[model samples]
Target: MAALILILLLALILGGAGFAVHILWWIAVIVAVLWLLGFVFRSAGTGGTRGRWYRW
Candidate 1:
């Protein structure tokens, strides 16, 4: 998702879509940054956060 957004951003900037780029640039940047933050802070998915829920 984030990679696709980045590609689209690059394309918009390089393709001379000035108005489109100006409007959507913040959205693309926000999505990409949020994705990065989620990747960095995500749990290990080992059921540690679930505690006894998995055992039940």
Candidate 2:
């Protein structure tokens, strides 16, 4: 009985980890798209040339 409970707990933990990883992947994709859009539509800065959207 204890072994069965341990197996179930392990499965639950692994399943939760998998779900979290999937969500992180989606977030990464969204951030990448936003970054690309920012690069494409960046505003002009000093010298009348395009400047980085991010300070870094």
- Top candidate on lDDT is 2
RMSD of 2: 1.0
lDDT of 1 by residue, 1-56 (tens): 99999999998788777777877998899988987876666655565562222223
True lDDT of residue 53, candidate 2:
90
Q: Rate the local accuracy (lDDT) of all candidates.
A: 0.73, 0.96
The collision pairs in model 1 are: none
Task: Give the lDDT of residue 32 in candidate 2.
Answer: 96
lDDT of 2 by residue, 1-56 (tens): 99999999999999999999999999999999998999899999999988889888
TM-score of 2: 0.90
